[model samples]
Target: MTMSAHGRPLRGLADLRTLTGRSDTQIPAHKAYLRISFLELEKARRMQEIRTANDRFAVVNARFREIDAEIADILASLNGTAPRAHALEAPHRSAVGLRPVKRQFQISY
Candidate 1:
């Protein structure tokens, strides 16, 4: 089965139903309340999905940084420079890297 961004498979309906407190219930719930509860559950699911994606992104970004540092170390050795002790130090150390982008909106008649 395919895995989710959270490193686990998507939860089955039983798991979702359990979270919604409807898994073991025998009596039927009102249609209106059921609909509202489902909507809220969906919202929670979406939030979890976004959180998982962000977590995955963070892991991938960290791996990329490690790879980049290793490559830089190799390049330094090739150039006959001193072996970089702190090879993982960011290139733009203590630099403000963020710049605001100005957007122009044009309206045509």
Candidate 2:
């Protein structure tokens, strides 16, 4: 009773052929169904991988943005100007719904 990521139960080749009500003599139909099932499973697996990669990219992008903000703050201070409002903002959740760890930066004049 293996289940797919979409919660659908996967069926064996025999079970699939039986469900089609095709007799053993109908080998072509069984082969066609098996190919279709294989393709569908492959598609689901690839899609899951893509989603995982997207989540990782989002986390990396968020970290880069935080670094940019820190750099901006340092530049402003060196120029004797006020820092941006978001310079010292609290850690926020990324697209993956995970909050990044807070980091402290010390700047010497």
Lowest-scoring 10 consecutive residues by lDDT in candidate 1? 16-25
Predict model 1's lDDT versus the native.
Answer: 0.82
- Candidate 2 ranges with C-alpha deviation above 4 Å: 1-27, 80-109
State the lDDT of candidate 1 residue by residue for 9-85, as single tens digits.
Answer: 66675665434544654545687689889999999999999999999999999999999999998988788755567
TM-score of each: 0.44, 0.47
Q: Which pairs clash in model 2?
A: none
TM-score of 1: 0.44
Summarize candidate 2's per-residue lDDT along 1-109 as a digit string, tens digits: 6678999776776664434554565568878999999999999999999999999999999999999999988887789655556656778856796667797777989
Instruction: Report how far residue 67 has shifted in candidate 1, in Å.
Output: 0.8
